[model samples]
Target: MLPFTYALRNLFRDPSRLAQTVGGAALVVLLMVSAAALNHGMTQVLSASGSPNNVIIMGAGSEESIERSEVHLEAEAAAATGIDNTATILGTPAVSGEITYQAPIRTESGKEEPALLRGVLPKALLVHTTVRLLEGTFPNSGEVMVGKLAHRKLGIPENEIAVGKTLYFGNVAHKISGTFSAPGTVLESEIWFDRNDLSTLTQRDTLSAIYARLDNPEDFDNAHVFTLLRNDLELSALREDDYYSKLESFYAPIKIMIWLTVSLVAAGAIFGGLNTLYAAFGSRTREMATLQSIGYTRKALLVSLLQESLLATMSGTLIALLIASLFLEGITVPFSVGTFTLTLSPSVLITGLTTGLLLGTLGALPPAIRTLAPKLNKALRS
Candidate 1:
């Protein structure tokens, strides 16, 4: 068998071919890594945003979108009174009536972009247990609280929306009261307002939804039963986690499109790399035949060729990882509902490594075998 150094030395034989193989592998791996990270981040944020112990009560036929849902303002009091096994703190039922609105609002810089706005009472903190105030006080009349990552969704710098800054809604300006964070959840991309303030500003008398926190997951049935029994309320009850799961399904098409795009682009890169390998191996046929005459087996030659290919592809994988760490990590991406940050999790890293191995081994096979196929004398004389 040829020494391993023989494989290593052959990789540098043609500088252009080496660069092509490495660059192609890098592009393919990078695309796949990015797609995996994007899908994972989006799915995680949606899933983490909801809690199994919480239930959302919305108007009938509006289960798909909270922003479109409308319920009587009295529903909050009714649910608090009717639902059993609800979580309570100091004898106060953990129920919050909220209004959700999406509209473009101007920052202090006069920049306008669409923002997800939620109107809630202080009791909102009871039901959305993940939320924690990062700085300043909660909003009062003419004041609003911003999420820690709200600036990402608004396409502005964080300092632009710091506490004490101002946001304009129509002709009125609201002070930035504080910043809050709900880690790993979509709530981190919203701006929250006092329920009454939002109702007056949006000119809506109804609540968009009622949030109730139950003592346990099994207590969801009690809330569901309450909704069914109250025919006059026209309310539909759904578990918070289930609602977000439906949202995840709603975004399934986007995830599919991402994979489709990666597949098409990676197909082109794979074919291009294969062609480069074929040409490079074809030109080395005589050299392989001479090695065989020196008692090196065809199998040994094939292994050496694969070793060379793996080295190039693995180098490309390292380059891709470096680029992702520098540019892709912690990138905040905003969508219709919220924003998510891209991360190179363990699963994404494993996927990239596997892709590089497959490209190097399977992509090099046909060319390596073909180059060694000729009779030893025939190949040497060619």
Candidate 2:
């Protein structure tokens, strides 16, 4: 068997080739890490956006989109009844009727971009525990409170919609009276206004949805039953967690697209690296034949080739980790509905490492086999 040191020393025989292998592996692993981070960031945002203890009631036919749902104001009161263990504050059940709209708004810089507009009563803050006022005050009539990541979602310069700035939506102008944040949740990219004001502005007499907090998440079954029994309200009840889970499913296509891109690029990298390996190892055929003549087995030579390949790929993996940390870690990516911070969590790191090892194993096999296929006399002559 070839000594471990034998393989280690061979890596430095051609420093330029060694560098190419390592650099290629690094670029491939970097793409893997970036793709994994994007998936993690989006999944985390969807999973964390909903609270288990909250329930949403929307019009029966519009379960997929809150903006399309419409319930008479009386539906809020109807849905609030018959649910046990409901959360309450100051003797009022933590319930809110809300409306949602998506429209293009002109920022202070006069750049127009689509923004999600949510109109909620004061009680929404109590029901949605993730939200909190970060500065100034809640919005009043003719005013709006921007979410912390609203500018990112709008693709505008940071602080361009800061407090006291005016933004034009449709024909009406609204003041940015405050900013709010809902950490680790999708609510951080919405603009909030008084529900009545938004309804009047948009000519909407019905609410898009109703939110309620329950004392125990288990009571969601009762809430669902209540919605089924009340044909009068024409509403359907769904647990907030279940709703967000559906959102994850809804974003499944985006995830597939990301994977498709990575797969296509990684395939190119693997084939490119394989060609390089063929050239590199093909040139060393005589040396490998000489080692075999010196009592080294074919398995030993194959293992040595794989070891060198893994070493280069692992070095590239390390470089990818550093780059992901420096650039992708904590970077905020905005989507149509919200923004999420790219995370370099342990899971993402593990994914990158696994991809690197797989590349090394697969990339080294063809060349290693080709090098050993020729008879000893033929290899020596070559």
Candidate 3:
């Protein structure tokens, strides 16, 4: 058997080949890591945005989009009174009748971009338990509260939307009174306004939806039954967690596109790396043949070659991980609905390490076999 040092020493024999192998592996592994992280972040944010103990009541026909739903103001009173097992804080019922709008708003720099807006009353806090006021106060008649990541969605610098700044909704300006956070949820990318203020500004007479929190998740059927019995209200009830799960399904095509793009690019890099390995191994045929003559088995030579390949690929994997930590971690990406932060979660790390191992083992097999294929005499002559 070839000593471990033999494979280690051979790597330094050609500086250019060593660099190519390592660089190619790094590029391929980095692309895979990026894809995994992006998809995981998007899914994670959506899943965390909903609570099992809450139920959403939207207009019957607009179940897919809350922004387009229109519910009569009277439905709020009906839901609070009719829904059984409703959760409460002190004596107030955990119900929030709100409006959701998407429109362009001008920043302090006069730059305009479309942003999500939610209109809510103080009771909104009861239904959305994840939200926390990080600074300042809740929006009042002439004020608005910004989410911690709203700037990313608005395509502006963080200072542009900081507290004390003003944002223009058409000709009227509203003070940025506060900033709030809903960690790992889509709510962090929205601008929240007082319910009455948004109603007058948007000229909306109807509520977009009503959110109600139940004492137990199993009580969901009671809420669903309430909607059925009050057919005159034209309302539909759905568990909040199920609503977000449906949104995740709606974005399936976008995730598929991301994977397709990564696979195409990685294929090109893999083939390029394979060609380099074939050339590097081809040139060492005579040396391998000499080792066989010295009583070293062909299987031993193959293992040594694989060891050399694994070392280079693993080094490249480390480099890729370092780069990801420095640049990709905590970076926010905005989509149509909200913004999500990239994270190197356990699943993403496992994906990257597995990709590196596959490339090192399977990617090296073809060239290693071809190099040792010829008879000893023929290989020596070459």
For candidate 3, the TM-score is: 0.99
Model 3 misses residue 207 by how many Å? 0.9
Give the C-alpha miss distance for residue 338 in model 1, angstroms: 0.8
lDDT of 2 by residue, 50-73 (tens): 999999899998888888899889
Clashes of each: 0, 0, 0
Query: Candidate 3 lDDT, tens digit per residue, 1-382?
Result: 7999999998999999999999988998899999999999999999999999999999999999999999999999999999999998999999999999999989879999999999999999999999999999999989999999999999899999999999999988999999999999999999999999999999989999999999999999989999999999999998999999999999999999999999999899999999999999999999999999999999999999999999999888989988999999999999988999999999999989998999899999999999999999999999
Candidate 3: misplaced stretches above 4 Å? none
How well does each candidate superpose onto the true structure, as a TM-score?
Answer: 0.98, 0.96, 0.99
What TM-score does prediction 1 earn?
A: 0.98
| Candidate 1 minimal-lDDT segment of 10 residues | 102-111
RMSD of each: 0.9, 1.6, 0.8
- Better by lDDT, candidate 3 or 1: 1
By lDDT: ranked, best first:
1, 3, 2
